[model samples]
Target: MGKNTWIALFAVVSTLGACAQNDIRPTVRISPPIAPESTAMAEATVTMPPSGYLDYCMRNPAECPSSARDATHPEPMTPLRWAELDRVNTMVNASVRYVTDASLYSRQEYWTYPNGRGDCEDYVLAKRKMLLDRGWRAETLLIGVALDLEGLRHAVLIAATDKGDFVLDNQLEQVVAWQETGYTWEKRQTAANPNIWVALTGDAAAPEPFEAPATQPILVANAHGAESKPEVGTAAPAHTIRQDAEHAESTPALFASTTDAILTIPTPKPRPLLTARPVSADTFSLSYTTETPVIDTAERGGAINGAS
Candidate 1:
């Protein structure tokens, strides 16, 4: 072969060998981009169970219902299921009488499904058990804590249905929509995982610290119906107003200013007039005159003669 031809053949062989080495190297795989809608759906679906419920489950694992650990998500609720939910809620509410945990269990807080008489948590657990037995998915039946209409801490069973979330409260016999319950939801069991819980967003966030509402200044009235103003330098006495039972038990007394604390100052009576002076003669003066008329006898005699 010619020298140029040999050189060209050697260069071709080297290029082919380099290409084979490159082909033998490991290949890298790239993941597909996640869709925004899916990401949002995932975020929206994520939830957390109540802390009390979790603690109860941990302490009494055997007592914990199977629904708590069930990973299967519930199907959308149908009309039949909705009717069943109402019936079950009403049945449980009517059957169980309201009683405090402290009175029954000798503890301040206990979560259990009571047999005859029980408190709020008991009512929630009983309803959950009945629904779960009726084939409702555990994920759909969530136990949550919220402030009731009276701003009291209460436990309720939240049924996540296709229609919307509905609340079963012991205080109310009707199974009302969750939004209509007037509750400030705090935390609830995750729909995906019952063992885990997430803090609820928006209204579910830890409630703002309870602020005793501003009290209007009360006006103190006297026997004469005259309102008296408080003295400038006097400090108003502090009045303690007991808040709702939940707050009253957990928090300190809320201090407020009341009219009862206002000091009453008696009005000074006017002094009677003591000095009396005599009236002067010039102050009361009067003028008077008397006169008499004489009779005309001569004229009378002339009238008598003319008549005769």
Candidate 2:
């Protein structure tokens, strides 16, 4: 090692000088994650450290690995950045969280938030949306729908981080191998748009078809919500068509927060008189259903059923 190497070593040591072992606190215990409400299975905890991450600064040297000839010597990654990304992916998905179970609902959009409901596709979609907001590349995140070792349809998020392809899944909180996740490959889709997600079942893996990369400029603003749109109530094309396709493949739980989007939401307005039309497959349905009253409740907390 030369002068530059020595400087990098000193910088790392200086950063770690304040991490005293005695200042660390005992770990807090946490039980294994369960459905919305159920018995806990395991427990673990994290404690506070005096300097928090100061120890890592020393543990991971600031300098590039000695084998590198220059700053960008590594083709895909440097040792340090790869490890950092892995650490993040592992922690973020450490506890597979879901609003409910995966079998009661048929498709990703079927059920509302309830205790232990929704399918596997529902789980993958939710985590991908969260990670996107954290600044992952939209093009790089792929949702892989497949079958797990248990031979059930499953969906998982494939994140191309500095540490290679890291997976964020709903089966376990810890981000693990795409192979270890036990999802036999079925289909891959672009995370941002579902319309263009599906390909011809088992074709070759090209980002696009047997075509060249387009030359169109991708504006980051319109592409990634750089500027907010101000109008609504008539944005999404009002078409009347729908699809009844339900294949046995995995997908994440898909829901988008539309408060900020241009898509209109229900407003307290009278329905405009017009001929009724069914929505098409290209469009989405905001369908709802209500049943006849089974019991009557007066203002007081008393229930009355016809027979009981």
Find the candidate with the highest lDDT and give its number: 1
Clashes of 1: 7
Model 2's lDDT to the true fold? 0.29
TM-scores of the candidates in the order shown = 0.47, 0.36
Judging by TM-score against the true structure, name the best candidate.
1
All candidates' lDDT scores?
A: 0.42, 0.29
Residue-level lDDT for 280 in candidate 2: 27
- Candidate 2 error regions (>4 Å): 1-119, 161-164, 190-194, 198-256, 263-308
> C-alpha displacement of 142 in model 1, angstroms?
0.6
Q: What C-alpha lDDT, on a 0 to 100 scale, does residue 115 get in candidate 1?
A: 60
Every model's Cα RMSD, please? 43.8, 24.2
